[model samples]
Target: MTTTSTPAPPRIALHRDRLLPAEPATRGIARELYAAVRDLPIVSPHGHVPAQWLADDVPFPDPTALLITPDHYLTRLLHARGVPLADLGVGVADPTSAQSRAAFRLLCRHWPVFRGTPVKLWLEQVLVEVLGVDLVPSDDTADDLYDAIAERVADRGFRPRALYDRFGIDVLATTDDPCDDLAHHAALRDDPGWHGRVVPTFRPDRYLEAGLPGWADRVDALGEAAGVDTGSLAGWVDAMERRRAHFAEHGAVSADHGHRDAVMAPLDAAEGERLYARARAGHATPAEAETLRRGLLFEMARMSADDGLVMTLHPGVSRDHHAPSRERLGTDIGADIPVAAEFTEALRPVLHAFGTHPRFRLVVFTIDETTFSRELAPLAGFYPSLYVGAPWWFLDAPDAMDRYRAAVTETAGFAKTSGFVDDTRAYLSIPARHDASRRADAAYLARLVADHRLTLDEAHETARDLVTTIPREAFRL
Candidate 1:
């Protein structure tokens, strides 16, 4: 059998009419506001795209792998609508039998399902504005779109580094395991041709608790990586310090934690040491696990203070909804569900210890919108070290973003909040997601200006800060 290369598709044009704002008065305001910050450099302070992709500079495989298979947002929604995961080449399904091209066609066929969805908006923006394909992707145009994208993937311009430059990214951060070698980051820092700033963010969920299935093995690996013994509590702390220093050497500016809830327990040194020993022995009870996790969190916060790494907490997730999937996929396969989170009371201990310190920075994220006005905004408003994180996970859409600003901005103001952070694993959607955020922010500001709440000039300045300045300052980029 023989396969031939496909030809490139014609460029898609984004006219001035496609811009948001339909009202005559607000339309001009929106356009002017967008113009002031549309081309500002993107500072992506938090994300999950690995640095290896940029360091090695490899071409992405295909539409199935790039778009359909890996994107939980795409597959999970499709699965919810009765489309089997196998059809999308997810799980342990056989890709050859599934027909990867047909999966792409099916996604395009069902593209209308995403109509008011953030996925649809991001896809349209990327298709029309970034990828330069004007035609709407549907059953009629699926094959053509797939072939065009595939052809581009084989081109040098579509490589990760090229896309990084074309996207106008000033700095990009990838989330990394505490036990990671970070060799790829070192390679990128040494390469002169690849000048784009790619950094790492420390994520220490695995090492902090022992309830996870493979904690013993993970601890041993951490010990080997950091040149410390894994048998003792003090040694484990030393190993963490070593790994943190390694991450810092590779340009890490922040540390990220995703806890079950915003709970913390302040334990004395002896108690913490005893709990750590029990956890390492795989004999930790539920209460012990919770206490140890919280204790390590406080330790992580203290380590951030000592090392100058900004601490970011993404709490309130109930991971692993499907036990079978958890057994098969391990974790983070779109099964995580959000629950109620308490910011004020749960974080009181940690906040009381470090909130007044000027050098300590803590960014708090939540899935509970109910906490925005009542708790989070108020907490961020008062604490010198606290900043509210951007609308996260399920809340990163246009409506949610606007609601966030409305809920918190009056009380906390713009400075108390961190700017947009695309916490996505899908690499291609980075520019699209950021573009949607920029437009949504501009639209919101336009409304404010039209309402006489803020002047057009002030809105323009605020737009620039939200897109560029705030993220840099908040994450220490």
Candidate 2:
């Protein structure tokens, strides 16, 4: 007699209560809190997704490009495990099918490296939840999973804008250089067929870093973009203000800064002009550049006070910490490492100037977790214009997020905390990142409820606000 048997179930499936508390009572409350906001429209006030992708609304080439290549969070880990970035199609404009397939296989074969990581959570979510791939990633399942994802991405309905809608993103913000023409943003805005709200964020980090190579040329480019002559400090300021106006006219709600530190100091006009000349002439010492950058950051806060653009700053990053990696693959390939940050003293000058300014809004972010209670919470508690930014960058993990809520909520309360910011370049992982944040927050709130610190009704209300009202108000959306 021959017997037919059902195939074994897939190796792994996402747990319905993956990040919920282990205790039954807290878990129940968390499940309820999560259900209330699980399907809410995503409000991404800050990210690095390119505007052109949505403007063109093109179908992604393959799973590797869509999932593995563009996400440094994955690529950097793969690179650490003896994989060359080039082999992973890191900078390849159009990777051939074979190349892409190999990269995907490599990722699958090395999936163990991502265990206990948020990358694992996001990948599993994307594979099963987003793309409907049932099989777990492994050496044996790489080809099948790749084929499945490739087929899905090839469909017209899987185009960027379609996915944007499918992701239920109410508002997505893309970071842009000060010299950008924003033509792609204009295209999306003018397209009558599109109804999604995508806004540009003015990121002026490169323009402010006088110590970087080609600072003068970039300043000149910035001036040309704004139709001004940036020959002096005052001229540069005027050019930046005009470009900001242009951004505001095009619906930008925030200005982003990612300097090395959070220092914002004032400079006299004479000293500012002198430092500007030195920087432009390529003769500025490191100290002079530091002074100029800090003064310029102070000016940025001043500009925000005047223009009503929310000033968002994430500092304490030592960008390109690994010189060889940067030289080999250029920057932002996840070599950026966080250093200890001192916000209390560094931000004193800027805070004193704009902390109570009615029009000024500053959201400060850091990867350094130590600042949560010691510095950020107290600052946010006292300053009407300041909001403690969510756990960001490396600290965007579950435990860190729970710690953040515990640390800040005591002093600043929920209202003074900026809602979760994805802060990602991996466009496809946006939903997964936000989902992780939501779950972490729900778990935290459930603990509060279980501990009698908050009622269930209050927890539900706060959960809703975290994903909606908080982000809108924090980013001034």
TM-score of each: 0.94, 0.98
Q: Note each model's CA RMSD in angstroms.
A: 4.6, 1.7
Candidate 1 structure, TM-score to reference: 0.94
RMSD of model 2 against the true structure: 1.7
Query: Model 1, 95-185: lDDT tens per residue?
Result: 7623889889888778767867888767676776666677677777888888888887888998899989989989999999987888999
Clashing pairs in 1: 12-132
List ranges where model 1 is wrong by over 4 Å. Answer: 1-22, 92-94
Residues 207-259, model 2: lDDT tens digits: 88999999999999999998989999999999999999999988899999998
Query: In each prediction, how many residue pairs overlap at the backbone (N, C-alpha, C within less than 3 A)?
Result: 1, 0
Model 1: lDDT to the true structure: 0.84
- The regions of model 2 sitting more than 4 angstroms off are 1-10
